[model samples]
Target: MAKPQPTDAQTDAEPENTEAAESEARDPAQALADIEAAFDAERAEMRDRLMRALAELENTRKRAEKDRREAAIYGGSKLARDLLPVFDNLNRALNAADDQTRAAAKGLVEGVELTHRELLAVLGRHGVERVSPKPGDQFDPHLHEAMFEAPVPQYAAGQIIQVMTDGFRLHDQLLRPAQVGVSSTPSG
Candidate 1:
């Protein structure tokens, strides 16, 4: 028996049928390897993305914690700054009482002194410290505010000649710089 030849339509359809034929013609092991490699590449990319996301989350958490700590420490800064003048007035009142005033009003002077000391203790407990710069100490710009310059014969240039008002600090932060006079005279 003789077999009939394929028609023109069937011949055109042969190319379209090659997709199945090509897969069957290729080595099965090679095809499986290609699929496995594609899956491995996708898995690696996903893992990399996941790791980056986790690192970003960790960094955000650390930043939030640091911000919280800073807020806790510095939240009362405005209130502390406002109270500095009250502290200054107390010191001035104590200084105004001389020996005669103390003799005449010993009880009053003692009460004022006690009040001043208590205020200082309260401030110290809250981390507020006075930056007291004595006369003849080296002038430090970081802790002292230069209110005036004087050419005192006994002091060298840049030395503190007089302290006007003491400064206050809240922990490591300076709330106010100590007001002072710096000597302009050169050391002979």
Candidate 2:
């Protein structure tokens, strides 16, 4: 008679089964405690992984919301900047008109004036505002750019002496700082 060979699966599992049976037989309560401890360790590891995933998901949500808000606020900034030169050219034309020119071409001047007003109105609707600082006013580096510094007797040092062009602001952001000359005279 030929003896049947033990199957590979049965051979591999025999040692682990024997060890468990021996442990259980030695002290049943201790074996039960060991099983409970292993389950607890696995449960803790799974709980830690779930908590980390939840935290990452929350951070991604907050970052997405912030990006959406910034896009809404500053999305048109490039177009706004491009249109600034157009506004400056229009203003220059109006400024160059003297009393003689105005009298000679009153209708033409009026048309240009109307167009300029309309342009300003359109810009205002989109949150652009002029930052025209006058001479003798305090210079604000945030809103005005110092193109030159000179000792002017009429104004104290740090005061704006002249404004070459008006600045523009869109919401809290400055599109162009007012081109200015700050006084450099020593204050008494």
Candidate 3:
């Protein structure tokens, strides 16, 4: 028996339908492009997230280090401040002693001097420093507290005429500001 041939209606329908079916099949190049585009988008997003997390971690580390340094520098500020008067009294005693008296009390004076020196050295080792303002230096508000403004024509205005108390510093932090008298005169 002979095989039946397709009708005209079936033939016409096949051409249109065949083209539609062929187009629906995946194109290797287009599929590869789409896959690459998706991969690229995912990689970029992940990289952005990673960089932000790293930056935040670095910032946190820096802040912690700063806090630790500050704690080390100013930990004994109250105790150190309280000891200032003892040092002042020692200095005053040494200053008031005359040569004959100092010689007679040499051993005692030397002992007190040695103790005072050792105390200052220990404080210096721990980042504590004395700020001794000179008689003619300019008065700085950050390091000097003006107790009074004196009228003196021999020095320039704002010059430190007197320093009532010495200042102290623990690293970059001020433990105490120097008590000073600023000049009111305009010229030397």
Candidate 4:
């Protein structure tokens, strides 16, 4: 068979196609470098995700440990609160006893005093402490409940003139507020 003569368009396109084929043919080292770059990028992305997951896990563990410690520290708060009324009654009984009555029942009074002291010691050991604000001390609204206001010559306004009931605290937290009377008017 005889070869056909090339058209002008076909001749023109041939060189461009050859150039494209030559460009597509890459160096082996360059090809390997390209592959390594892609693999490195993928590895770096996976490592970042793994690091984030580990950080989140550590944070969760720390949070859980804090919660457990708080639970252990404040676990007996409710029981301690419930026992306050009993302590108050004991104090009231001691206050109600007349001098003659106390003398007559000295042994009984002494027993009650000892019991009160022991209970207080146990409570103190567990971080529970008494909040007894003395008369003429400055009244704190956070720790005291003002049952009534009265004018008194001895105390300035906003001063505690009387404490009706002693308060109690568990650590820095107020278990009960002190019942108190505040001086309403300033002393002359």
CA lDDT, every model vs. true structure: 0.90, 0.91, 0.87, 0.90
TM-score of 2: 0.82
Among all windows of 10 consecutive residues in model 1, the one with the lowest summed lDDT is 19-28
Can you give the lDDT of residue 143 in candidate 4? 93
lDDT, model 4, position 107: 95
Task: Return the top candidate by TM-score.
Answer: 1
Write candidate 3's Cα lDDT for 39-73 as tens digits: 99999999999999999999999999999977777
Give the per-residue lDDT digits (tens) of candidate 2, residues 46-158. 99999999999999999999999878877877888888888898899999999999999999999989998998898888888889999999999899999999988888889
**Which runs in model 1 stand beyond 4 Å of their true positions?**
1-9, 99-109
TM-score of each prediction = 0.83, 0.82, 0.63, 0.76
Local lDDT at 50 for model 3:
100
In model 4, which runs have C-alpha deviations exceeding 4 angstroms?
A: 2-34
For model 4, the local distance difference test gives 0.90
What digit string (tens of lDDT, one per residue) describes model 4 on residues 3-84?
Answer: 9998999999999998867756746667788899999999999999999999999999999999998878887789889988
Please tell me which model should have the higher TM-score, number 3 or number 4: 4
Error of 2 at 107 (Å): 2.8
Q: Could you give candidate 1's per-residue lDDT for residues 83-172 as a string of tens digits?
A: 888889988988999999999999998998998888889888888888999999999999999999978988889999998999999889
Clashes of each: 0, 0, 0, 0
| Best candidate (score: lDDT) | 2
Model 4 RMSD in angstroms: 4.5
